[model samples]
Target: MKPRLLLTLATVLGFSAGTVQADTIGDPVRGEQLFKRDCAACHQLGEGAVNRVGPQLNGVFDRRAGSLASFSYSKGMSRMGADGLTWTLETLDAYLANPRSLVSGTRMSYRGMKEQQDRSALMAYLRTWSDKPQNIPEASPTARPTVPELDPKILAIQGDPAYGEYLSSECTTCHQRDGSDQGIPAITRWPQDDFVAAMHAYKQKLRPHPVMQMMASRLTDEEIASLAAYFAALD
Candidate 1:
């Protein structure tokens, strides 16, 4: 390559890289403004409010899902808690973009923030609550045993377990037997309602997880409910 051309190319590359880096570094001040406007309706800021529509945002940044004492989380959130997933900035960004996409059946009714700037702002705002450095939890080292106790919920309505099993065949690619995978986590022992909500989320595009999006897109509401029942019934 010619010296002048090489230098010009290098300069362009450097500028592009710098711009990308700048974009990812969220502004906490802007984030706070966005939070108050968008998220404050459901979530309370600071440590003062005990509980509101949603759990208090105080210390929520590093907290695990469903860890709040006061709020009643959906089964999906509870499952996330049991699995030990924490709310880091990156995770929060993704969740804020689409709640169901992150945890499948979370009961967070708010639609996602479509803009990247909005998501980044939300993440920055959430960071103010946590005292410690934030990190997401690793998958459980031990394999999860299927809980037979949950069968009643899954089998509550008349449906064929055989059909449920057949329908669930599609989920095995991502959910896996053990539930540990990249982006995709384990679903064993998940709450029945949460499972239902997750499918609903996907069907509605409220949850935008790619594989679940595709799968949920394919199934009817009844099919989703049936699959939820079957998974809940699995031991």
Candidate 2:
């Protein structure tokens, strides 16, 4: 095979494997649980749920920020609304990651939700009340941290296969013992480079699925490499 052709094939395969494991939606049940624990004090979800510290959020979807008729909005928020910014899944994800970063002096005092999975679940829960929930945006192929960039460095580190074997138990719950595709795809016997790339894609949010993002985020590079080594040897 030509050198250029091999490189192209590798790149395509790397991204294809990563994209296959991508997840976009989250468990709404988990979302509701997170909301009740984290946001219930300030925001209300049900129709009869009235505004507490923050305004009632029944119609927040696609509604301009700070434009709620009955509630008093901060100067920053009002300015944002006047500028025609509406709440969509994308906007909400950004805002929830860091409110002050998005809008400089918002009255909401709670610190932003830092976890991507948590934000995704919260968004799902919030959408239940929205008349028109924004659809999950398609993940672009060029998002970032491609296989060529991230794969080699992690693979360079020596990984402990025994520890990885211990870690593989939880994975077996979704990925079958026989490594057969049963709705969810199997992760066994993946090439080390491809596995590293896929995990990085999830951790970097290049791939969708907040749950996978969260799971990937929790794993260190060494751990990922270890798992890769373990799975590669499994075949």
Instruction: Please give, for residues 110-189, the per-residue lDDT of candidate 2 as tens digits.
Output: 78899988988888777777764234333211111222234445546777888788877767877875789979888888
lDDT score of model 2?
Answer: 0.77
Best by lDDT: 2
Model 1 TM-score, 2 decimals? 0.46
How accurate locally, in lDDT, is each candidate? 0.69, 0.77
TM-score of every model versus the real structure = 0.46, 0.48
RMSD to the hidden true structure, all candidates: 18.8, 13.9
Task: Provide the global lDDT of candidate 1 against the true structure.
Answer: 0.69
Report the lDDT tens digits of candidate 1 across residue range 1-235.
2545654786887655344312333567898888888878888887675677878887776678899877898898999889988876667768888888988888789888999877766666666555643243332111112222223343345445577789877788768756566776777657778987887688679997777776776665556667767777777
